[model samples]
Target: MHVKYLIIGAGPTGLGAAHRLTELGEHSVLVLERNPYAGGLAASFRDAAGFTWDIGGHVVFSHYTYFDNLVDALLGGEYLEHMRIARVRIAERWVPYPFQNNIRHLPPDMQWECVQALLPGHRREVAPTNFAEWFEYVFGAGIAKYFMRPYNFKVWATPAEMMSYQWIGERVSVVNLEMVLRNLVLQLDNVSWGPNNLFRFPQQGGTGEIFTRLAARLGDKVRLNTPVAAVDPASRAVHTADGQTITYDKLLTTGPLDILIRDQIGAGPAAAMVGDGMRAAAGQLARNGVYVAGVGVNGTRDDDTCWMYFPESNAPFYRLTNFHNYSPRNAARPGHQRALMAETSWSDHKPEQLDTLMDKTIEGLVNTSMLHPDETARIASRWSIAVDYGYPVPTPGRDDALRCIQPWLEAHGIYSRGRFGGWKYEAANMDHSVMQGVEWAGRMVLGEEETTYKL
Candidate 1:
């Protein structure tokens, strides 16, 4: 069958692109997906208790008005907007978020320990081109040495030294030396600019609901379970895993760029360059995540908080959230029966054994006192899924490699955009990812500038 565009991966990004195309009256579009459902990583799994768990924690925070406007256009009803009440869990202590900026909240000795080597004057003197250097420059030696460095390793499964700091643009805020010192003297919390400062979430369903509903708006354009197996760029034909071939004038690939290149264009100096970009990225990545481990405790209180982060090495999970508090339906019950969701991460190559990691995660919560070890709470069903490229690794030489690969793909008329598609962590949030699709459709049909793809 002939189509104007063939969009692969029925995730939010692809759906966004398709919706835009449909809205603009572009009918010759085919959206394909391997999964039976849309939403990709934004998809959620529900347990028998009516509790919904996002593949990973996704909050709708957008820098682009197009994304914000489109989501509102598709979405109806009251979406919850919560001020961020996040904290960092380190060394069994709950330090307010932007841990480096607020570590003064810790015990005096702990504060002194972090401040001693981090006098702002004696910080690392190197040029600090890598992530570790940037960490030292932003947080100083003590905080970086103690929390920022090790905790990141536990998450990305890579060392900071190997990472590049370019991707931290909007994802992480640089520490304020003056404010940090001032706050150290007087106990105070710091609020800073970040993408998800005040964000929205569905009132009932999880983030997946947004995508599913968005897909519904597309009518019959999406073809689920349509995994693209191969593509012949010469004739612009895509082969599905089921041995069906579809020809299109243009193709948008949301799968991993390196894999798509190797499969479609074959390996060579060009393929090696793309692969090197991925490897260079891996050196910086602390990839993989384990989530949806909850505790059903008795009695519910109004001690509502959004999400908490962990910077200490002792804590296995880097983040925790009071799910019930985010939306009562997240936990879906009241009274003393409380449920909490925490997330931990690992790497693909060196994954922590499922059973072993689960044990450690629970113990970690107990050890941290977030959950009392002695308290009896039935361990409800746990949800664990390994997102291969959960967080894109931004390392040095990445731009060089993307520069080489992107143009080559463009020459072949193939557009790759998304979280993993572009390998941009800063612009890889739910909203940004959706905008990537929307903007790509604009480029395809309207010949307008590529917005999300620009960065």
Candidate 2:
């Protein structure tokens, strides 16, 4: 099969590219997805009990007008807009998110500790090397110790010292001393911070509906359950596992750069040593796997919070999103039901018990006051999914690795873009991922310069 563009992985990135290509009046496009469904990590599934669960907590917020327009056109009136009401569970108490900004909510002594740490003139590092140093420099010692350090360690599944600080643009809320002191003095609640302060979600299905609807619009151009075994970029051909060779003028891949380099590209003559350094850098790439366990309850839930972050080790899960609160249709039972999606991270530094993960996760919810122990009787459904490529850790070496790998792939008519493809957690968000695709297609077809994919 010959096509002008052969897109790999029918997730947000691939779908976005195909959608843009078609929008530009390019018909010769084929999307090949390994899974039977589109959306990749963004996919959603309804359990046997009928509760719809997303891969993780996916909220729809955009940095680009193009992305907002795409989602609006697709979902139309089926989507729900929400004001983000997020919190953090620390010291067995609930505090408004941007923990540093809301230190007044903590006990007297703890508040003093945080305030005293900030009382000194802000300490700015001339050159902060790691995330740990960056946190200390930006948030001071107390806030860093109380919240940033432990919380980040749990979320990243790697030491804060091991990761880089470049990817933290709008993702991490920095400490605002003026606002924090004012809130403390007046005992005000400072909950508003971050770009996801307001977001949208599908009213009916989970987050996956957006992509599934997009894939449907693309129609016959999408090929599911067809995993590509290898791509001979030398001949501009992709060999499928089932013995199908697809030759393309340009190939857009959204799969993991490391996997594509090690498995598909291998040590081909186009570049023999390509596999060695890329493979070594891939091993150095700091990334953590996530285990999302969905707990469905038949009874009504009291909390109206969207999601909450847990920094302490008392809970196994780092963050929990009230799935049912996001959308009422997420409930499986007829009367009143609630669903909580808890995310647990695991890496070589932090190993997790996969077998007892569900049970432990339940215990964690109880410990964190997210679920009452007595509410266990009202449990309707329980399921867990392990996502290998959850969060791409922004290690110090990540940019260097991408700099080496991306140029090589593009030189041979292969464009790697997406969460894991680009390997940038900052731009790995839903809106950013899709725009990466849109921008990639524009660059390929219209000779436009790409912004999101720049190293």
Candidate 3:
């Protein structure tokens, strides 16, 4: 009924925070989770046919030594190391991961169009006002049209003009005219541009294995099937759906910041504590939903590709991963079976009919050359999961909103840090999410300044 530190949502951020707090000799900690299991969006599922699938395509490629050490200690030798083999599907051809860097792989006319648009003075010289302008300013009209614009719209489910460009960081591979021309002329493939070129995965379970092990270490410190209905900042108490009230000295919430501020807090007497500016800021935050469809077949393909991006509408899904390649155990039969996982995003800007998504996804696989028409009969299993909070959109007003909301929460002993809680796509990766929690714990216990996430 009481604790020194209380965490909501036993996802990576909450688990990381509790784990770090324990490491700091703080055991009076409790993690409350709404789901029956752990891992949050990073969770995995096993289908009736014995196929393993993640919520979406998640690969373990970290930017922090702390995360690396933690993963190593947890998984030990149970994980498999992999070199990322990412690609893009354009004009019925497989271009390397960075579509702009590998325009040479496109058709002759398309390649020339891209090269012509990148010629001197072809790009805008003015400062970009939004993601749309930013891409055109940096990549020109041809590349933006063929890849950046369409693919981003597909994945984010938001118009480029409505989103901010500050989150680009290392997520996008920026290239110049000279570099593009050199690669085009030299027939070179710039596959090794991003940090995820070398990654790791669980050899047995899906990406959720790491978090499952972490929650196990925390033992009974984590409570599953417990969803918080409201947070009373006045009394520093969390009311669960089942009518139990848990009081805490400090609170770290890993749920959607918008829901926490606008719905949960607004529902109670603490509503008066949240100012109009904070509520308006919460309205500015946006997110997209994702539909993950896993198709298991009786036969296997010998492709070495890890995942492929689809900018064209030929496929209903924006991305597809060869799940079987991540680990042989992911499929029912190691060598004879195949598992293809497709991810389709939706939001107010983009809507999808869920009932027919599976059929469309399979048709997409055939259209994208992942499957044949006759092979549809060989399909043994079809599994799908829909998550409402997929990617957090980095709108133009995100930073300003965070400035208005985060400080107020921190002042009230509430620290929200994670993908949806922080609402920062750039820092929402697995490593960054864990480090945000680790940094928050460090700040709480040792008075160290938080570094991974800053307003």
Candidate 4:
């Protein structure tokens, strides 16, 4: 089989690329997806008990107009727009999102602790060298100690010291002492701080509906259940596990960049072509695993909050989403049930007992006030999935490593993109992932410069 553009993994990136290619009057594009369905990590699944769950917590929010239009065209009137009501569970209180800006909600003593740490002389004046230092440098010791450090550790599953602070773009809300004090003194809530303050969700099918619709538009161009076994960049061909060799003029792989380089390319006949430096750079790339557990209860609550973050050890999960709130159809009984989805991250630095994770997640719900202790028996369904590649850790070496590896892959007419493929958490949002593909297609066909996943 031969194609002008062959994409691996029919996730948002692959589908976006193929769709754009077809839009640009290119018909020889093909997409290969390992899963039986599309959407990749953004995919949703309906459990046997009839509760819908996303891979993690994914909301439809974008930074680009092209992405906005594509989503509007794909989902149309089938989506629900929402004002983000995010919160953080800290010090036995529900502090508003951007915990640093809402410390006034904390206990008097704890509020003073946060304020004292932000005092002129208390904050370090030295330049930050890593994520941990950056937290202290930007948020001061109190906010960093109470929220930034622990919460980041729980989410990334790697010590902040081992990661870089460069990826902190709009993903983090940076606050100065003045803004913090103003909010604290006036008792203002800074909930509308980030890009996702206003987002969208499909009325049904969780987040995967957009991709399902997109893959449908591509027709036979997308091949499901086709996992790539090896890639011979020298020959510009991909060997699938089904024993089919597909050659491509240009290849876009949306799989993990490390696995694509190390397991596929480096282990294939073109191993010598990869060289030692790229392989080592591939090894330097790090990512944590995420376990998503959906707990469906027999009754719904009146809470309007969207999601809550957990930084304390009392909860096994780092974040919990009110899945039922995103779309009532997410629950089996709609208005009568609650779908509580929790996410826990794991890596070598932080090992979790997956076998007991579901139980731990349920216990976490009770600890975080998401569920009543007695409501445990009303649990109708418990569905869980663990993805090995979750958020790609932005280690200090990431940029240098990408500098070393991406150019070589591009030299071989291969573009590895998306969340894990690009290995950039900042650009790993649904919009960014899709736009990365759209930009890749634009660059290939229109000679346009790719902007989303720049090295």
Candidate 5:
């Protein structure tokens, strides 16, 4: 089968690209996915209890108007607006997210110590050499010691010094001292501007609904359970796992671009370069999340709070989500039922030790105060996904390596784009991933100005 564009990896990016193609009346397309359904890692599953669990906790918040327009066009009426009340739990305390900003509630000495770190005079001009240094430069050594350093290390699975600080806008909390003081006095401390600060949730199925809908729109055009073995860009023919050699004019690979290229072409010097291009950063999924477990409690909470984080050495998983608060449907049990989901992460993958991890995670949760040791609640289900490649570790060498190599691939008629495709962790969220695909397609179809994933 010959087509105008042969799209690989039937995730949001690929689906978004296809949508843009179809809207432009360029419908000669074929989407190939290794899985049977669309939505790649963001897909949803129906449990034995008839409740849907998003592969992990996927909370969608759109920063681009184009993205909003597309979602409204696709899943328009089904979307539900949610008021975000995310929090962070640290040192056996329920601190608000952006634990740094709203930390005035601590004991007087602790609060004074934190404030001393935040003083304007203490913040001198120091060009931070690394991510950790940047944190120290901005928040001062005091705050860094209390929360910034260890908490981040737990989450990123790498020392802050090992990573870069470029992706720090809108994502991290910058404490406006005046506002922080006012909130401290008023006792209202929450991350008020997080992208997820206030977002939308699909009334029914989790974030996976968005992709499922997109795939349905593509209909039979989306070929699933068909992993492409090799794509001979020379002849524009793609050989599938089941021996289907389909041809195309141009190929848009949303699969981690370098992997597809490297595997397609054997591991020679060029392939080695391709592999390096693909394996950007620390060559490790930095922010790996282990969903400790989700327990559906029979009763409601004292308050309506969202995801809470812990930034200390004591907690096994750094964060926990009252998944039910995001949407009423997150809970599988009856009305006012509570669903508590937690996560744990590691810097490397050791699949062999996962069975032991299950026991360890349970004990860790109890230790962290997220769960009570004495309370025997019905665990609706206990499951975990390695998340294959969770977060792109943005180390010091990341940007330089990617910049040096991405253009090389393009010279050979390949567009390496997407969270893993381009290998940019900062921009790898669902919105950015979909936009990467759409923008790549625009380049293919209309030769539009490229949207740099970095900026």
Candidate 6:
């Protein structure tokens, strides 16, 4: 079988490419998705108890106008506008997010320590090498020690020293000493720092609905349950699990780049040696898997809080999003029940017992007061999903590895574009991933330049 454009993995990126290609009046595009569903990582599920849960904590916020327009066009009025009500559970207190700016909520002694570290002459002159050093340099000892270090470790499943600082731009909240001091003195909440301060979510199915709706427009162009087993870059073809060989003039992959380089791509002895080096370099790129535990409660949840963060070890989850709060319809009976989605990250550095993760997560919710003792009887449903390709941790040499791997793939008429495909946590948000696919289509089909996938 032959196609002009063959796209793999019908996630946001693959769907984005298909949608854009069709919109551009091109009909020679085919999308292959391994799962029976369209949305890969963005897929949502409805439990037996009628609560809807996303793959993880997903909020619809965009950095591009195209993404916004796409989501708007797809979702239309079937979305809920939300004001982000996020918090950090630190020192057993719900401090406003951007914890450094809201240190005043801590005990007086702790506040004094943070302020002292922020003092003008108390700053340390440390040349930043790793994320730890950058955290210390930017957030100072007090803030770093109290929140940044522990929280990031929980989220990344690796020590800050093992990660890089380049992806921290716009993703992290940099504290202003003067503003922090002013907030501390006046006891003001500086919770509005991130781009997701105001966001949107689907009113019906979940975040996954956005992609599913887009995929519906593609119809038979998207082939579900077609898992690519091997890729022959020399022949510009892919062998699927069912023994079908599909040839393409150009291929776009939206899966893990490392997996593609290691298992899929076939090469000669000399190229294999180079591939080994590339694999080693790709291995150096740190990434952590996520266990998403969704707890559906039978009782009413009146709180309007969107999500919250946990820095303490008592909770196995680093972040918890009130899934029902995103949209009341997310819960089975609307005002009668609620859904709580908790996320836990783990890797070789941080191992997790998958079988017991759901139980541990529930106990953690109780420990963190998310699930009260009296509310245990009202537990409607308990489910856990482990996502293999979760957060892509950025290491110092990640960019260099991508720089080498991407050019080689481009030379072979292959484009890896998405969250793990691009390997850029900075631009790996939903919007960026979709735009990467859209731009990849433009580059391949229309001979236009691709922007987001630049290494």
Mind giving the per-residue lDDT tens digits that candidate 5 earns over 1-455?
Answer: 78888788889888888888887788898899998879987787656654556665678787788888878877777767777776666656667667777786676677777777777877535799888988778777667877888778767777787888987766687666677677777887656667777677777777788898999998878999999777665565778889888887777777764455457643422344444545552243233434445555566647677677777656566667776676678667635566666666675531225556656666766777656776435455565555645566777776776776566556656566776677777777888888888887787878887674652
List TM-score per model, in order: 0.91, 0.97, 0.99, 0.99, 0.89, 0.97
Q: lDDT for each of the candidates?
A: 0.72, 0.88, 0.93, 0.93, 0.70, 0.87
Q: Report the error of model 3 at residue 201, Å.
A: 0.4
Residues forming the 10-long window of minimal summed lDDT in candidate 2:
267-276
- For TM-score, candidate 1 versus 4, the one ahead is 4
> Candidate 6 overall Cα lDDT vs. reference?
0.87
TM-score of 4: 0.99
Which digits, one per residue and each the tens of the lDDT, describe model 2 over residues 301-398? 57889999999988888999999888989889634998989999999988998889999989999999888999988888998899888899998888
Model with the higher TM-score, candidate 3 or 6: 3
Report the Cα lDDT for candidate 3: 0.93
Please write out the lDDT profile of model 4 over residues 93-176, one tens digit for every residue. Answer: 899998988999999988888888889888878999999999888888888989999999999999999998988888788877
Runs of candidate 5 exceeding 4 Å displacement: 120-125, 177-190, 267-292, 334-336, 349-352, 452-455
- The C-alpha RMSD of each candidate to the native structure, in angstroms, is 3.2, 1.5, 0.9, 0.9, 3.1, 1.6
Worst 10 residues of 4 by lDDT: 183-192
lDDT by residue (tens digit), candidate 3, 254-304: 999999998889877588888888899999999999999999999976799
Instruction: Give lDDT for model 2.
Output: 0.88
